[model samples]
Target: MPTAPCLQTILALVPRKRAFAASNCRHASLTGGTTIIQAGQIAWVRSACPAGSGPCIFRVLPLHRDGFSIPVTDTPAGNRGARRGSGGITLDDVARLAGVSAITVSRALNTPERVSPDTREKVRLAVEHTGYVPNLLAGGLASNRSRLVAALVPTIAGPVFLETIEALTDALARRGYQLMLGQSGYGESREDALIDAIVGRRPDGIVLTGIMRSEGGRRRLLASGIPVVETWDLTPTPVDMLVGFSHEQVGEVAARFLMDKGYRRPAVVTGDDHRAIQRRTGFERAFAERGIHGVPVFTVPAPTTLGSGREALRALRLAHPELDVLACSSDVLAHGAIVEAHAEGLSVPRDIAVMGFGDLAFARDAHPAITTVRIDGTGIGRQAAAFIADRAEGRAFGQKVVDIGFSLVERASA
Candidate 1:
């Protein structure tokens, strides 16, 4: 005998027909791997039964659509999310456990303001007993505000953005808001997928690490109606508000710092990030303004590590041994460069002056202590939090754009 085909293959074997007569609407139970495609009630129900279990009949609730709907393989939450007998925990389960009505449980959890103190206590205990986590996506319909804020960062590998993140988390928590963090990496493409998920969560506000560069990402943010705060990069036209420094200004200042130190042969060791590149651009432009040309630049993968910084210096040395200044995109990279310089028997500042960005904790601790560009990362975070909270609370800010500005920390390295 031929092997049994999967339900998907079986469904493909059936002929498409329109509007079965009421008598012909015979019930058919579906088991795991069993799927049926029917007109009018175009629901793709999945059996909770273990795979290869025998077929069992199920009665589906009425599904109505005014017109053609895109084929749905999964049921929408609004239709089945509240169904009491689906085995998943529902409001009814909590109510039954708490010896209260379903409405009471909902009121206790979502609108505690309207529920009695004693009833709220009972619902809370029941929820804790059942280990039930409310589906915030469903509960969002009643509350309108999820009381959640989302923060997007390029990477969390290094401490480059730790100050800002810590501040944002604490600030939001103080305002009765929770922070939902998403790492988009250094690539713009990763942001699109993250934005889609964040928008679906219906967060009260969104805090982004850098300004959104992609058109699709910006459009989705604008459509979300959530307050947005773009941090760490300056832009006049933001999705909502901006609290950051000018990467261009940082780069120019980095160049000027090295130049003032009497170092003319400068090279920048940078990660391939949008803001880092902007800083590099500014650095080179400053050089060009002083009739200096072709400043050497080495770019490594973003959220750069010490190893990449070491490799960058070696590569730069091979190309230009006369290169004197190493402008690193991050403190970790700067630390790497300093180590590599010592290994190469080059004296810091005398042979190769190292400069770093972010002014991370380790920057000052390194031997010869790195000179770096310091931005008030925590300040930016606090201000961004304020902007988001105020916007969520329907309060207007005095300024929609904030340029926290950057500082060049003069240390022993340069």
Candidate 2:
């Protein structure tokens, strides 16, 4: 939401220093040192990382009063032949073991099409035998690109994000950027680690699943120059850019839908995540407008499974026996609620109406056909890709903040 500082302003803020900034830094991974402008990207030269490097990377801390910061390299002196960055296998070692040139190894790893099948197979076998990992930072340094983007999601096991991931993957691939995924789980600690790791890698862009809520995390993101896209939820004060819908709006519409259907004792089954809570707030506020109060919420862990859904229903049933409708934060939760209804000898929509968010692939296929709120996840994916690609390629585009929006999918369940 805050205006990002201009590049020149940022550059002016940090003073030029000859010495490395500090020692005993803890962060993840490496980005090649030395930067230049090319191909519409801020290309950088990647410095070498010897095996058993003392530290993986340096971080950009809060700007000092001097308006300058020093970035440090990771590799320690000596033992260069034994290890690379992160003390892992180096490409040179792989080339040596494979009886091929390092260039051939790079071609085999980065662009196998440029190498003969026989040579590719040889490099592949050598890679397998040596456990040699390609340092993408080196390649990025050489080519003046870390043609990578990182997407941080709560959990990869959930189906709600799969569509966006698939679409985003395809779209970015067409533009020559590889996707690096990180699972932030369900809390701040995970987010902190992921942020440090991601920014350290110097990814061209970062795509987050929801608005960053933690103060420390938000500050960290704002400090970096990388382009970011926050998806699945919206906020006027996004870290950089955003592509999502309003959770409160979904909740209000869903709650009203149930009320319009004449279901009075409606309860919500929600995952215990930030966005889910916002949707629940909207749901509660809308019901309050209709003179409804004390609407119960059964909360469960994130990446809600069918079992959790069923269990949530059972728990709610004990407390609110007269409940006739179940609204969920995700289709997966709704699906579980339907299964539990059958267990209670209740017929969906007849004995109980159900509504869910996220019109997942299986929503329509469910026995009672889930009625849910639908967001244009594919559209979000495509636009997010464009946002990153356009920025990385130095193309100007309007509207850094985008609300791809959502829809209501009415079905038999509701």
Candidate 3:
């Protein structure tokens, strides 16, 4: 489809600077000249608030972009025994309060295994009591590597993506990368914003659920120089690495299966996803070869539910009562179609045949076990992990199109 656009050339936008500095400047002006807090650093200056005779109350203002707060106090500049350190309790103070050395406390917090269990527990309790928060920004700046891998998914409400996400998380964890997830919610602008926010953090790697992205987002991603992995949909040229099967192939295969089974009038139940639409296009093209016209297609909103399946079937029956076969975009939808057929007093495969994509865990567990196409999600995951590993380690990775073929798991449904 459209030659699957160039992976790198498609997304080459320039990277924008992190917005924290500008945000901090605005915050400083608004809060008077009491303190200058930016990034992870906080400095105390003379209080600009009105002078009062009694002890002046300290004001805490949260710096939105920097992710730290500014603390202001009205204590006299040279007062006796006045607190003159940073706002929060320091790690040394926590260690002292716990009656342990700073190194032991650090070890306890970062690597508890090396320290005694008793000492670790004592240090943890002291830390909680002292309300000490680790300065992650300072640590990240020092290392220049956040060790955070940002992942952007179309939506988390859909189950079709859960397997890939779980696999990605586990795979990155094995490589010492923590996944920071963001939901794009099927909006291009939202995806762009999320990408900008994620790239600003300078994550070690970025994983996208789909290959499609806005031009600006693509450019920023390319400029970030982070390892990128696109999954769940296939393209000839990938931005970095591709791990998915073709939706068009899935549609053609299903149509052929239905034709071979001698179903004259076949209808389809599809979701609104771009990949699903592609499958629908392929299905229609394949069905046209059999001289089928007005082949009764029903579409439902994305993140498809069983109710949509049931409604699609009911709609099809009203329009084309003779429609004997139905192909669904997902097994979840197929299950709903089967339930709807039963509700209408029709026996599956005998009175009405059904087929579905995604032979998920529940595909075989239904009353009339659903016949579906099986794609090895776990295998795709492993392949994606291998691709990322090879790139990250500077190894030669060849063979771009890895078609871990699909199989038709025939059952009682069709």
TM-score each candidate. 0.71, 0.69, 0.69
Model 1: per-residue Cα lDDT at residue 341: 89
What lDDT does the true structure give each of the candidates?
0.77, 0.78, 0.72
Better of 1 and 2 by TM-score: 1
Winning model by lDDT: 2
**Candidate 1 structure quality by residue, lDDT tens digits, 1-414:** 422221210111112343321211112343233344453233333444334532222222222322221111222223443233333445665686577998889878766889889999989976764456788777767768788999999878778788999998898888877888899987888898999999987899999999999999999999878889999988878898999989999999888878887988999898888899999999999999998999888999987999998898899999999988899999889989989889999999898899999898877889999999888988998998999899888886698998899888999998
Candidate 2 accuracy as TM-score? 0.69
Count of backbone collisions within predicted model 1 = 2
Question: What are the RMSD figures for all models against the true structure?
Answer: 12.7, 17.7, 15.1
* Order of models, best lDDT first: 2, 1, 3
lDDT, model 2, position 57: 30
Query: Residue 41 of candidate 3: its Cα lDDT?
Result: 35
lDDT of 2 by residue, 1-414 (tens): 322211110111122332222222222233433433221122122333333333233322222234333222333334343233343446665676567998999988878899999999989876765446677777899976698999998888888888899899999998878999999998989898899999988898999999898888888888988899999888979998889999999899888888898888989899899999999999999999999999999989887889988998899989988989999999999999899989999899888888888999999999899999998889989989999999998999999888887889999999
- Writing each residue's lDDT as its tens digit, candidate 3 over 1-414 gives 211111000000112232222121212223433342333333333333233322223323222232332222224434553444444556665676577998898778656789998998889876665457766566568666666778888788767777877877788677655778999877689989998898888877777877755778778878888788787788876776677888888888889888998988899999887888888888888899888867778998887899999999999989889889999999989999999999999999999999988888888999799999887777776677666666665679887557666788989899
